[model samples]
Structures are given as C-alpha cells and as structure tokens.
Target chain A: MECLEVYAWLQAYLDSGVTAEQERAVEAHIRACPYCRRKLVAMARVVNALERTSDISPRADFTRRLYEALEEEAGHPLAPRPREPRR
Target chain B: MDLRLLERCRQGHLEAFGDLVSRYQSRIHTLAYRMLHSREEAEDVTQETFLNVYRALGTFQGERFSPWIYKIASNLCLDFLRRRRHSTVSLNAPIGPEGDIPREIADETQLPEDVALAGALGLDVQRAIDALPPKYRTVIVLRHIEDLTYEEIAEIMVLPLGTVKTRLFRAREILRVSLARSD
Candidate 1:
C-alpha cells in the first residue's frame, strides 16, 4: 500500500478494526517503510496520551451541590418517597 | 440503563430520580468538563442537565438512558461555550478554595503532589484538546473520554455517521500536529 492509502486507513488499522487483508497489507507496508512506521509511532503516542488521561471527578461536594440545585429548582425537598399514599 | 429506576422515575418516585443522578453525575460532569474546559461551568452544566432530565423524564421513551443524558449535557455545554466565545479564561485560573486549576480538579484521582509533579505533560495534551474547535472537541471527548461508539456519538451529536468519522479523524490529526509542535 502506498503512503496515502496507509494514512487514510491508519486509524482503523491502529484501532484493529480493519479487515484482515487490509491489516496485513498495512503491516507489510509499515515493515518496509520507515517513514510510515514513524508516522504510526507518532499517531500511537497521541492515542496513548488520550487513553491514559484519567477520568476526572468534580469537587468533593459535587453530589451535594447538584442535589441542592435540583431541590431549589424542584421547589420542594427531594426526599425519599413514602411507602403509602398520603390522603 | 436501569429500567427499574427509569420506571420508578416515570412513576414519580423522587428517590428513583436521585438514583439516576447518582449513577450518571460523574460521567455527565466529566463530559461537560472536557467540552467546556471549566470546572465551574461543567458543574453548572451537569446540574442543568440532570434537572432537565428530571423535568423531561415523562417524555423519555428511549430504551437507553445514557445517550439521552449525554445529548442534553452536550447541548448545554455547547451553548455555554457559544455564549462565552469572546471571553477566555485561563485553564490555570483558580477554581477552588485550595487554589487548584481546572485541570487539577479534573483528575482528582491523583494526589495533589503527584498531579503537580506529572501534570505538565498532561496539561499540554489538555491544552491541545482545548484548542480544538468545539465541533472537533465534542466528538473527541465523546469518543475517547466517554468511550462512546461512533453510532452513539452520531446519535448524540445528531450528525451523520460519516460526518462524525470525518470530524474525529480531523480532530486527531489536529491533536497530532499540535502535540508535535509543543514537543
């Protein structure tokens, strides 16, 4: 495969979603081509950085604050439901 | 999605609504944060999202709840970004009592000291992401951070799958070149 073709399919190839025949062709091309190989490495680094970035939590009182805002909008206390109907 | 909780919510069970909030707050908050790049704004968006979710629960007829929640949150975040387009805030600006930056508040999984020590590179990556246009940023955050599939992202963004794929490819290419420049 030529460099343009490889570039077009690089993401799918790296993600391993490409067909087996396509994967083999891309792998063979990368093996023979140093430039394409370097491109792959660079792209891989970018993906790795993204994947390694941890999911961040909001502040300690995230739930509390959210509940409070919800209550204010609700205009009534968001208390647990009573088991029986209040006549 | 918890069908039981949804059913209870539809039945006017306040506790079930609370349960839904507890289950999705983190993810919805993270999505807002990544899209807006501001903790305060993200928190506001999260609150608004759940509130809207609660208000609209009666009309919800979808099999899954996640995409619906994300769709609401994404719209709110995008609107927030659009309104604040001219005014720019430093991502390093103090956002908490302890004087932590938005990025620091984002990754609370790490100790303060560890975040301080190793946060430079992470901050660079975030900066590159922040620099992306809102369209690209939304798809990248949904695809990578939220781990949503292309079809789900397309659904949430209300775009064609081909558009989502094209935008994601462009977003990654932008990140690649931006990070390379930073190095």
Candidate 2:
C-alpha cells in the first residue's frame, strides 16, 4: 500500500481490525519507511496513553449528593434494597 | 445493570433506586468526567443521567442496563457541551488544523503538579481527549476510556457503524498529529 493509505489505515492496523491484506501492506510500508514507522510509534504511544488514563472519582459524598438531587427531582427518596451477591 | 435492582426501582422503591445509584454512580461519573473535563459538570451530568434513568425505569426493557445508562450520560454530556459553547466566548479560536474538531493538547510543563492524577503522560493524553470535539470525544471516551465496543459506541452515539468507525479513526489520526507535533 502507498504511504498515505498506510497512514489512513494505521489506526485500524494498530487496533488489529484491519483486513489481512491491508495489515501486510502496512507492515511492509512501515518496514521500508522511517516516517510512517515514526507515525506508527507515535500513534501507538497515543493509544497506549489512552489506556493509562486514570479513573476520575466523584466527590466524597457522590452517592449522598446524587440521592439529594434524586430526592429533589423524584420528590421522595427510595430505600436501599438488599443487594444480591455477585457470582 | 442489575435486573433485580431495576425491578425494585421500577416498583417505586427509593432504597432500591439508591442501591442502583450506588452501583452506577462511579462508572457514570467517570464517563462524565472523562467526556466533560470538568469535575463540576461531570458531577452534574452524572446526577442528571441517573435522574433521567430513574425517571425512565419503566420504559427500559434491555437486558443490560449499561448501554441505556451510557446513552443517557453521553447525550447529556453533548447537551452540556452545546450549551457551554453557546454561552461562553471561546478565548482560543481553534487548534486542530486537519479537521474542524477542536483538539486540546496541554503542554506538560504548563500542567500543574496536582492535575497529573494519572501522571504526566496519562494526563497529557487525557488533555488531548479533552480537546477533541464533542462527537469525537464521545467516541474516544466510550471506545477507549470507558472500554466499550465500537458497536456499543455506535449505539450510544446514535450513528451508523461505519460512521462511528470512520470518526474514531479520524479522531485517532488527529490525536496522532497532535502528539507528533508536540514531539
């Protein structure tokens, strides 16, 4: 595949969702081209960075706050039910 | 996503609903926070999502409640973004050159030490996500941060599968360019 096509399909190639033929073509192109290879590495770094994004927690009283909002919207508060054990 | 909790919620038990809230509040909040990049807005969006979900409990017939909840949360995030855009004057005109989607990539040195809850690299990536337009941001958040499938993302975004795939690929490409420029 050409460099531009390789660039276009690079994300899918990294995502492992590309067609086999496209994958082979991209792999060959990257092997032959430094710029595309650099793009691939950078793209991979970006994807890896996404997986590393830390979970953002709500406030300490998130549940209480949500219930308060719900209580206001719902006009009445519900009681907590017995939670079923997870399998 | 608990059927029993949902059933109890449908029966008008506030306690059952609270239990359901306990289950989803964190995940939903996380989704909102990632999408909005604002803790305050994220909190509001999370609360709004649960409120909408609670109000619509009787209408939800799906087996897994996650998709439905995610749909509501994402839509709310979009609405909030729209309102935010309309109300505020943008100090920065535009950033991304390749596309219309406004990309936000924060300078690492500029980021305060405290904001790097996910470390500098991770927070840099999150800032990149924050800069994405609402549509692209939603897809990236759902597919990457929230770890939902593309099909699930398509459902949440209410778009065709091909469109979602194309958008996601384009968004990744934009992110790639943004990161490449930074380096």
Candidate 3:
C-alpha cells in the first residue's frame, strides 16, 4: 500500500472497520515501511490520548444552579410555593 | 428515553422535567465544556439547553430523547462560539514560566489511574483539539468525546453522512499532525 492509501485507511484500520483483505494490505505496508509505521503509531497515540481523556463534570453546585435558573425561567417555583395561612 | 418520564414532562410535571435534567445534565455539560473550553460558558449552555428542552417539550413527538437533547446543547455551544469568535483566545497561548499549555481542572470523579495518565498528556491533547477549526472540532467532540455515531452527528449538524465522514477524517488527520508535532 502506498502512503496515500495508508492515510486513507488509517482510521478504519485503527477502528477495525476495514475488511480483512484491506487490513492485510495495510499491515503489510506498515511492516515494510518505517515512515508509514511511525505515522501510524503517532496517529494511534493521538487517538489513545483522546479516548483516555476524562469526561469532566460541571461544578459541584451545577444541579442546584440549574434548577434555580430553570425555576426563574419558568416564572414559578419548581415545587409548589408554600401557601399563606388561610386569610 | 424513559417514555413515562417523557410523558410526564410533556404533561407539565415539573418534577419529571427535573428528572430529565438530572439525567442529562452531565453529558450536556461535558459537551458544552469541550466545545467552548470554558466552565462558565458550559454551565450557561447546559442551563439554557434544559430550559429550551422544557419549553419545546410540547412539540416533541416521541422522537429519541438523547439525540434531541444533544442537538439543542450542540447548537447552543455553536452559538456561543460564534458570538465569542472575536474575543476567543487561542488554546495554545503560553502559560507559566515554562510556557506550558494550561491544564483543564481535573475531574475528581474520574478513576485515579486515568486521571494520572491524563495529567501527563491531557493538556496537550486538549490544546490540539482547541486548535482545530470549529467544523473539525465539532465532529471530533461528537465522535470521540460523546461517542455518537457518524449518522447521529450528521443529523445533529444538519449535514450529510458523507460530509460527516469526510470532516471526521480531516479532523483526525489534523489532530495527528498536531499531536505529532507536540511530541
């Protein structure tokens, strides 16, 4: 496989989405070509870094703040307001 | 989608809407944060997303809830980015005496091992992502971060499937070059 073909299939190869025949071709190219192999490894590292990155949570009071904003937007208490003593 | 919860939400149950908010708040917040790279703005987007969802509940006709909510959150994030384009700082801007990129605040809930691993490389990866153009950034975030399918990304972005795939490929290529250079 040429360099362009290798680039074209690199993602699919990493995803394991390529067919067995295509995989073999790509693998053969990588085994034979040092430059392509380094490129593949670097690309794989990028993918790994991305996949391993943590999914961050919002701040601790996110839920409370969100509810407060929602209530304000709704123009009413999210929960029923306490009734005044019987007039 | 909890049909019962959705039905209650559609019927004007505030608690049910709150339930939906609690269920999706984290994912929505994460998407917003990744897209905009600002906690304050991400929080704003998350809040607005649920509010929009609440208002539009009546119009929802039993379509899948996750993608619908994601669509709203993504649009809000995009709008925020567009409005801030003039003032936005490059994520690669040097920080500290050694000129390292700024690290995102760590998530306490993440696994210790993952957090440690991330501490080493996460900031670099984030900088690379932030350097991407918005179109490429959107696909990368949707696919890698949110784990959405290309089809779902197309629907959310209102683009064709082929466009989504092509954009994603281009995005990865850019990421690859950027990451390689950083190393």
Candidate 4:
C-alpha cells in the first residue's frame, strides 16, 4: 500500500480497528518508510500528551456545591438512596 | 451490572447521588475543561451535568451509565463553546492544502487558573489543542483525553459511526502537522 493509504489507516491502526491484511500492509510499509513512521510517532505523541493527564481534580467543595444545588433545585432534601454492598 | 450507582440515583437517593458525583465528577470536569479550556466553565458544566442527570434520570434506561453521562456532559460543553464563539478569524488557520480545514471562532483567553488546573500538557501542546477547530478538538478530546471508544464518541457527539471515524482521522493528521510545525 502507498504511504497515503497508510495515512488514511493510521488512526484506525492505532485504534486496532484495521483488518489483519490491512494491518500487515501498514506494518510492512512502516518498516520500510521513515516518513510514515515519523507521522505515526507524531500522532502517538499527541495522543500520549492527552492520555498522560488522567488525574484531574475538580474543586475541593465540588460535591458540597452539587448537593446544595440539588437541594435548592428540589426545594427540599431528598433521601439518600441505600446502596448495596459490593460483592 | 455496572450501573448500580445509577440504579440508586434513579430512586432520588441523595447519598447515591453523592456517591455518583464522587465517581464521575473528576471525569466530567476533565472532559469539560478539555473541551472549554476554562476552569470556571468546566466547574459550571460539571455542576449542571449532575443536576441534569438527576432531573432526567427517567430517560436513562441504558445498561451502562458512562456513555449516558458523558453524552450529557459533551452536549453541555458544545453549547458553551457555541455561545463563546465570536466572529474572529481563528489564530490556527490551515497550513496544509485546502478541503478539510476546521474553521473556528477563536477564544484564545486561557486564564492563570485554567493553566494551573491543566493536567500534564505543556503550553505548546495545550496551544495546539486550543488551536484546533471546535469539532476536531471535540473529537480529539473525546477519543484521546476521555479515552472513549469511537462508538461512545459517536453517541456523545450524536454523530454517525463513520463520521466519527472520519473526524478522528482528520483530527489526528491535523494535530500531527500542527504539533510538528510548533516544534
């Protein structure tokens, strides 16, 4: 397959959405081509940057504020639903 | 099976709601912040999302709750971005040949608090995400930052599955070129 075809498949390839035949072709093409490899790496870096930040926190009083808002919206307290213990 | 909290939430249980909030507040807030690029708006969206979730609990009959909640959050984010859009030529105009260029009204004001809360991204990478058009940025943020599948993204965005794939492909290439140029 041409580099352009591989370009079209790169995202799906990373997603593991491509067929085995298409995957092999992409692998073979990347093994032989530096430019496509660089493109793949660039996309990988961008994805990695996004994935690296998984520990984002909201404000300390976020739950308090939400509960307050819910109460205010309901104009009264709603009972807490009983939770089942995890097995 | 995974929607146990949602089942409790359906009964108007405040504690169940609190537990639910604890479960998804960070994720919902992160998604909003990534989409809106503003700490203030992210907080507002997070607050509003749960409220809507409470009010609309009857509508959620799905087996899994994440996609449903994420759909609510993503919709709220889109509405905010739409309202904030102004009539300015965007800063990140196309560098490649024309055709699939994403045109967005620029909202370039990232406050100190915004940067303070931004998780692991350096300024340049953040700017690259900021520079993308809203549609592409939404796809990138949903797929990459939210770690959502293409099907879930399609649902959140209310788009066809094929459209989601097309957008993801285009968004990745655009980011690749933009990040490389920034380097």
- Candidate that scores best on TM-score: 4
**lDDT of the structure predicted as candidate 3:** 0.73
Per-residue CA lDDT of candidate 3, range B1-183, in tens? 556778997677767776776677777877887777777898899989988987787888746788788888998987887677657654443245543333343323434433432323476676677666777778888988888887899988889988988888877877887676666
When 2 and 3 are scored with DockQ, the better candidate is 2
Predicted candidate 4 versus true structure: per-residue lDDT over A1-87, tens digit per residue: 788878767778888899998898888999999989888888888778878886467777666677778889989976553232121
- Candidate 3 residue lDDT tens string, A14-70: 767689988988999999999888888887877777776555666667777777777
Error of 2 at A74 (Å): 2.7
Sort the candidates on lDDT, descending order: 4, 1, 2, 3
Computed on C-alphas against the true complex, the DockQ of each candidate is 0.32, 0.44, 0.29, 0.47
Give lDDT per model, in order: 0.75, 0.74, 0.73, 0.77
Name the DockQ score for candidate 1.
0.32
Give per-model TM-scores.
0.83, 0.85, 0.82, 0.86
Worst 10 residues of 2 chain A by lDDT: A78-87
- Give the lowest summed-lDDT range of ten residues in model 3 chain B: B99-108
Candidate 4 Cα outliers beyond 4 Å, as residue runs: A78-87, B86-111
Q: By DockQ thresholds, what CAPRI class is model 4?
A: acceptable
User: What is candidate 3's CA lDDT for residue A38?
Assistant: 88
Residues B18-54, model 4: lDDT tens digits: 6787778888888888877777898999999989998
Higher DockQ: candidate 1 or 4?
A: 4
